[model samples]
Target: MTRVKQQKPAASPAPAPSIPAIPKPDVPARLAALPGLPIGELKAEWRRLFATEPPPYNRRFLESRLAYRIQELAYGGLRPETIARLDALGEQFDGRNITFRRIRHEQRPIAGTRLIREYQGVEHVVTVTRDGYEWQGRPYRSLSAIARAITGTRWNGWTFFGIRPRSGA
Candidate 1:
């Protein structure tokens, strides 16, 4: 019986070496390096982290947001309750809540604080009260009213008093 030579089974390929994962740097180290990174590098980082194109905002904005994002990723995002609370608060300001009235609480000067202004070489003092402002022994509902009383023309009370309006008001 002529038996055909049986071919030996091909040797299996050796398993590839397992490369160890490169450990991520600590959060603080990553954050500390943000300011020094070039803009291109920052954008690259943003793309890698967000998996999208970086915004067209300025460098400072990118840095600040990236810093926050880095920390957020390292730890965790806002709690669900906190996010819900923020969304509800946002709804109040976005005109979605029909009964919501914009309260100028932050715009109002603290009660009992004295505001002094000089117009036409005369010094005027106004006291901030809980309900309104007091000027020359008269309660005024708004600083504009007080300013109008001081200056014969309509003027922005904050501008007249050199009080810069709070940003994002």
Candidate 2:
């Protein structure tokens, strides 16, 4: 009688490596003291954390940036690819640098800037102010309202005034 040897089963594939968890840092309460800090003190705090001179901006701007920097130091900032993509997007938009916060707000024409449009063979001019747009010597809330007044229908002011590119463009 021939005795057969038992064959071992094939080895299974190795398991994937698990990612490690990141530890949270103990942030100082001073990070939250934005509103009350004086302008000079806020800039000093920014210099201490960033090791660079702060921009010449208002107190609220300085505080918000300092808070963001503090958090970025604790957590990771944007990836290089994401930043590159954003830079490309900024260039696409008339080669202007775009910040993350700027995306949250609508683009505004500078004060004293004028926007002209023609609707139904009539000329219309709107002047941008520090607070809002002025049309026909009347202060209005938004460009859309101005556009609606001009077209007698719903319209986006920026699009109507060529501030934004046309659709499909």
Candidate 3:
């Protein structure tokens, strides 16, 4: 009677597989390829800006764009009409597309007027600097320079382009 019941063996559980940790960003690409500014100057300013969060005028955008725009303004200046157009656009960049790197701080700075341009395809981040000017930061000094970096190719994001008035007035 004791041996009447048949015993069943338990199934073994599967072992968990290991996952890899996130890789660190390539410092060279991050530091080397600036849109229009000199490498040394950009490095110095990037160091200064990164330590602190985006100031008033930069706060509106995500951390990366805000950081990027600060670099842009150091090289190029924005245009007055562009600023007016942005206001008129009121969150619209032409009828079909729109993006923003807005001022999101305790007190936004008055840019007076800042130019906006589409370099590769995306909206180039533009902003006014403390010394009073606009700037752009994308594409690096050369496409080769950008290619040598992590992307292994040219970056197609916005760049600091010269201001051109909208025609057909």
TM-score of each: 0.46, 0.43, 0.21
What clash count does candidate 1 reach? 0
Error of 2 at 107 (Å): 4.7
By lDDT rank, best first, the candidates go 1, 2, 3
User: Using alpha carbons, what is the TM-score of model 3?
Assistant: 0.21
Worst 10 residues of 3 by lDDT: 97-106
* Residues 4-61, model 2: lDDT tens digits: 9899998998765432322345445657577788888898777777767889888878
lDDT comparing candidate 2 with the true structure: 0.74
Candidate 2 differs from the real structure by a C-alpha RMSD in angstroms, to one decimal, of 18.2
lDDT for each candidate structure: 0.80, 0.74, 0.41
Local error of candidate 1 at residue 165 (angstroms): 3.2
Lowest lDDT block of 10, candidate 1: 94-103
TM-score ranking of the models: 1, 2, 3
Model 2: what TM-score? 0.43
